[model samples]
Target: MTAPEPYAGVTTHTPVRHHILSVLVENKAGVLARIAGLFARRGFNIYSLAVAPAEGHARFSRVTIVVDAESAPLEQIVGQLNKLVNVVDIKDLAPRDALERELLLATLPVDDGNRAAVLEVVANAAASIVDVNATSLSVVLAGTPHACDLLERALEGFSDVELQRTGRVALPRLTQTESL
Candidate 1:
């Protein structure tokens, strides 16, 4: 038979869902490295990871990790994470139960000829122009992952555009009528 199309079967092997793990850990040196090393050694690919200090506390930090579910069983990942001495808590958030957001920043080369068009696209995407210079415009959008994706795709139409996205950071969704 003729050579199969490259990566034609890739989808068959790819995971259909991603797991979000919210891990609280001691804000100590090497804690992140240890966690990353564990995943690397186990061959589990991390889709995205974000870390930040928790509740303005110096002693604790929160790490949001997105993992491909098909890489390993969910329970196994949590169990291993629990064994880490620095890990204080772990919450495996289901997609429906979490509130997720990402930030997108893009710088686009603009001229008198295309400035209006570029601004129109930004407005349509609900992004704001944070900086404007003679030769370029810098835009920022903080929104859902899908919104960021759409804005990125729309910006690709302009030449010399540069884009960066913050990996997703998520928290459990609060129940309606529940006070924080």
Candidate 2:
């Protein structure tokens, strides 16, 4: 069997569909733990999660969570989250209505034997080499999940590769207001 591509741009291999949830919560100690515990107790699988301060204010934080939409009904997840004392709001940023991006950092072997070849691959992906040593190169790519997937796949042809991706962070598209 082929290894699972966990970050292949929200897959559909099973009955479960992927959903991106933007959770706004009080930026206080232990709130993250509480939220995580709720998912654990309910057996919800969070594919990717990133939490950081929202609106440059220390009073509130936003959590960008990618979860299996079918593991449980959407209402259940929302209800459970609402019960949390620190949770302020939950927004479902459906794929079509959001702008999503991820960052990938990969280190590949790049000695005289294949330096040119590796550079070619990186150039094709429009990624930049952020670090370089005598034997390896570290490339950084920030783009849509599919672009990152393609770059990762291409780098597989080379040897001694190590990669890490900052799962995903998405924001809902802005809508224009109409004058009354």
Candidate 3:
């Protein structure tokens, strides 16, 4: 048989499942390193990761990690995480129970021929034009992953584009009777 097309299987029929893990760890030097090393050793991929100090206590930090469920079983990942000395707690936040967002910055070459068109694209997506130089325009988009993806696609129409996206950060969605 002839060779299959290069991108034939890029899209799969089944949706990829991901799990959002909220890890609380001691906010001390090397804690992050230890956790990252654990994932490396286990051959698990962290799709997205964000870390920040937890509320009311500088001694603990919260890490939000997104992992492909198919890459490694949930129980295995959590078990390995729990074995770490600095890990204090792990909460698996289901998609329905969490709010997630990512930020993207894009710079595109803009000349008189395409400046207005680029501005229109940014306005249509509710993104902001953060800076404009003689030869380039920079934009910032902070929103849900889908929204960011849409903006990125729109910007691709322009040439000489540079883009950077922060991996997702998520928090639990609070119910009516719940409080943070």
Candidate 4:
């Protein structure tokens, strides 16, 4: 027999950390459940998951999920995730070069006082706030995971965060077609 393929991603000093997967699925209830169930069945740790309707129509929904697992089983997870009924396609944004990721966060108390600071930070990070109220604010940001991590570290202590992140939705930088 031939030698093994080294399991694709298993080795000493291999860093198993955060990864975001962009899933294209039918926009319907329980679709999320099946996706989550796949991870549960495999005993993977899901850091966060967010699903929403893709632009244009409600037929398509993009599910972004962050997971921590060694590379060895990563491909298996993606392959399995694609077999689900509702999941049309599955792609890992974390491993691609020139992939763009965005995250939206809702934090309480977005008034005049800290609003400027918040906006300032947003400007620095090239992010945007789409919703705001006297008591809460929601902002959409596009960047690498590091950018989200920095923003969370800075704002979490100061604001009441009802944190939700769209794991990581990405497309090729040169591509004209954009969708989950």
Tens-digit lDDT string for candidate 1 (19-78): 889999999999999999999998788888899999889999999998887888888888
Sort by lDDT, best first: what order?
A: 1, 3, 2, 4
Clashing pairs in 1: none
TM-score of 1: 0.86
Quote the lDDT for 24 in model 2: 95
What C-alpha lDDT do the candidate models reach, one value each?
Answer: 0.83, 0.82, 0.82, 0.66
* TM-score against native, each model: 0.86, 0.85, 0.85, 0.60
lDDT of 1: 0.83
For 1-180, candidate 4 gives per-residue lDDT tens digits of 221122343222213565567788998878888887878887776766777787676799977776676633777777788789888887676544437565657555666566667676667667778887667777767667668766655555455667765665555456434455
Q: Say which prediction, candidate 3 or candidate 4, comes out ahead on lDDT.
A: 3
Better of 1 and 3 by TM-score: 1
- Prediction 2 global C-alpha lDDT: 0.82
- Candidate numbers, best TM-score first, in rank order: 1, 2, 3, 4
Best-performing candidate as measured by lDDT: 1
